[model samples]
Target: MERKGESRGKTPRAPVTERDSSRSPKRASGLSREVVVSATAVKTANPLAEEFDLSASKSHGQEPLPVSFSSPPLLDGLRESVLQALGQSASPTPIQALSLKHLFSDIPEWRQYLLASETGSGKSIAYLLPMFHHLKKSELALPEPTSSTISSRSQRAVNPRALVLAPTHELSRQLSSFAKALLHNIKLRVLCASRANVKSTPRATFTASKMAAQFTDDADGTLGMPHLGVSRPVDVLVGTPNKLLEMARGRRWDRVKDETDKQLAAELSGSRSETSSKSPEPEMGLQNVEWVIVDEADILFDPDFQESTRTLLADVAAARGQPVPYTPDLLRSSPETSTTSTLTQNTPINYPFNLILTTATIPPSLATYLDVHHPTLTRLASPKLHRLPSTMKTEYEGWTGGNKDADIERRIRKVWAEDSIRSDFNGKRSKILIFCNKGTKVQSLGAFLEGKGIPNVALTKDSGARNFGNNHHLDGFLRTTNYKPKPKSSSLSEDKEPHVMITTSMLSRGLDFSPDVRHVFIADEPRNMVDFLHRAGRSARAGQAGKVVVFGKLKGRGSAKATEMKKKVGALRK
Candidate 1:
């Protein structure tokens, strides 16, 4: 079957280009570099590589990894649910297809993998499908419990079977939405715990009882027996690392309850007393997690999130009766010289649960980190992992110093006017994404564009974008607009002008824009190849053609910076 984004019939394999240091100029130290492959190389040329246009390798270089194109027969209900969730996409993308092969295989080592593929390649579905299938299978395997056993288990704390972690609240919510769609026909429940959700709801009203009611199971045990007394069990838990860490650590509810009761009594009697002490309760729910998927591995592993992420992973290991594989000190030490007390070269360590890390690009540092820390991690990479989409056209404009903002405004007007006359315009206003290096620039540029009579919206980390929630400006900008202007309604008509969104790098990764976004304007040069790829990837998604225009200064120190960025872009395109 043909994939959703590709053309009809078979696509011929493009030649792979390995990175040769002799053929290119030397790059500065500490900058991560990846081998360049053609974006059109969606078919494998090597016989050993097999189907799905994927290359399977090991971090430790132990042996040739096996490949499979066939997917095991899924349960009838699950198969239908998966197909329904996929919607018009009848077949899996290359990455999803390859991931299914290993996910259902008998090999235990294949359980742990690093899924590296380009943007818009259906990475979320690649992992979610297998996760749902496995969780369902495990549920069906369990025998019916007795009435007494049900009562006892219901009193116990919640222990989720699957956990998905994302770097941001918006990404976590998106992942949760996809998972919920997949489980629509099935009885399984998916829960999302994020700061956004918490902040939007009242603390008193956001109790476990209220959240549990939303996911309560019906009679006949279709949704599986509830682990919590009043709430349905969570099959999959998706959230940000900080929030999940807080949930996993739990709270001292007994002490809080005692303190509240004492305070009420004292209020009635006009007396004061010391608070009571109570032992802490068990964790909210991570003890029984079977599968842990870390989305956006690069961001999650960085210094900003490294500590919390490591602590959470260690907690999971401890709960699963396995040794903690990663620690701050261990991560700092050289992998060649570092040794674990629980692990030896001669011993084969058995992990209790499957761990999957997914990313769009595999930088040198990330590659090395995984190799040393997770030596047995199976690598599943698409042929276009580090390459830009073949259909994207990039334009570089030089800015020679003064009046940079004016220059950008003129360019925006030109692009907007050009888009207004396209044959496929369909009378609806097109959208453009303008990316800045900092949030302050985003605010200033957004205000400048508004003053220039352009309809625009700005989204920064603190701007509360939250995927268009509560941000009416962003909502109107992103919404479909094709209304006819009424007579004497020139102001209303101006609101329907071509929409432009100004934002910082916070919106660069994992956010999917509408097809109307055909142009990406980089107001500032990207810091690195990874940043450039993600920002450019905002357009030309799902095999659609798009354009990226980069504006850079061409004088003084800016000139040198622009020249260097130009070479990097050229290397990416090559």
Candidate 2:
């Protein structure tokens, strides 16, 4: 019998390989090559080399180009943007190369991909580059808007061609920034909609009325053009789920029409008109969206966010006139039946948009969820998915029964002292990241470290604590040693002391810290291997040498749990 979560006709996960010769470029001697202008001379240059037919070259006698195993063949515009964003000498990581190969293929089979790679492995660029390339191509194929239609188009409802959803506002903003960077040469417009963009307000008091008003009064005094400004139909939208959901559902303009009709009726009858009790219809902007990316898929699919994510998917499907795969109610009642029945009834569902789910780690729950819900998603995972980087060293400190705060303080000092001795320390303070399981612990530990004269910043899910954009201390700490912040009388100098950032797993998934963060301190035992991997992956990123110090207790069952965790970590390395 098959597994409970496994579907009957699911495609087996396979390693990414070049597609058929008709779609993919022919590889000579099992290597991909691209022609570029070169002045270097070749001693035995064969004008008629079998491996690389130089006769195809426009030039009469150009040398055989070296095979590029790192950089995959991409569109000219995308290639330039990639090199520009990641430096000319930099090349695509393993995940990036494989993903690009699959995405760049001309196979028109309604592709859905789940790109799982190790953290800091350029997953953002891997998806962003191809999405941009495809969108740009589509835009070019369309006829230019006439002068008469330009203004009308700008005032029309916001309809983005591509949408990227992130779990947190921070990650969403970061993804938007990266997307903007990739589009530096391209003309596509990238917009980020998150709570961060909205003015900070109490969640309970911020109702739909306030949101509608805010969106109305903000940009040119228009209704739909307020929040995002519909300046030009957004090309690519990056936002958190809640924010994107609101945008996708859109606002009700029928209220104005109802008010006008009621006034006219009152004038004609010389009496008040009964209010229309009909539900206001929503104008959807996601109808034209061709690409939908859910970054950090594991977190979004968790129970905490699963409902909203499912609703968003259903809304997108509805907008595109496709059958709803699974409603929230159906999933709650019977997920296996709802998903299987919806998908199996239709042998192949041609979704209007391509769905791409990117994550650093895929836990069993997420795996089961994907297999049951989206069995057709093609997975492109890296070889180093669950493993800790080889450059990262792990150290465990056990506390039998003592002041945990004091123990943490001592370890912080020890790490600082050790960092001071490094050859590249150069009298500059190093950065440390501390992960805690709870927000209360994060705050208390931050206060304790401050009392101990250790400069630190606390980041939590609380809106007040998460305003890192305005936190100069966090800005200074995350900046490089050469970074110079504007002078402030009350600001603590970042260079004078070692900076430690105390945060929950909120910063663990896709956020990138500075290279100065050489040490990661886990104040509490991670709940699982995925948590541990993400926490440790924050450091030792991009081939940087780093260390991880995990603190645990030795009393009662703590010792056994700690040992088991260590073994799991070791197994991941293998």
What are the lDDT figures for the candidates, one per model?
A: 0.61, 0.62
What TM-score goes with each of the models? 0.75, 0.74
lDDT of 2 at 106: 61
Q: How big is the positional error of residue 466 in model 2, measured in Å on the Cα after superposition?
A: 2.8
In terms of TM-score, which candidate is strongest? Answer: 1
Location of the lowest summed lDDT over 10 successive residues in candidate 2: 1-10
Please write out the lDDT profile of model 2 over residues 1-574, one tens digit for every residue: 0000111221212242322111112211221212121222122223112221121112122322212223344567667766665556564565665565567766665678877777767678768877888888878898988976554433324567888888877666556656665666767877776533344221233333333333421111112334532244568877777777765554323244776788788879988766543333332366678888988888887766788776787778787788555544432323434454654432333466788888877654555454445545666665566667778999998774568988888887787677679787875667889999999999998899888888778888883745533223356444222236566455445444547889999888777666678889998988777788789888877666788999986557648888777777666666
Look at candidate 1 and tell me the lDDT of residue 291: 90
Model 1, 193-294: lDDT tens per residue?
643333321123234443444443322112222344466567887777776776666444324677778977887898875654432433355657889899
TM-score, prediction 1? 0.75
Model 1 bad stretches (over 4 Å): 1-71, 85-89, 107-110, 147-158, 195-230, 251-283, 329-333, 336-350, 465-498, 555-557
Cα error, candidate 2, residue 566 (Å)? 0.7
Clashing pairs in 1: none
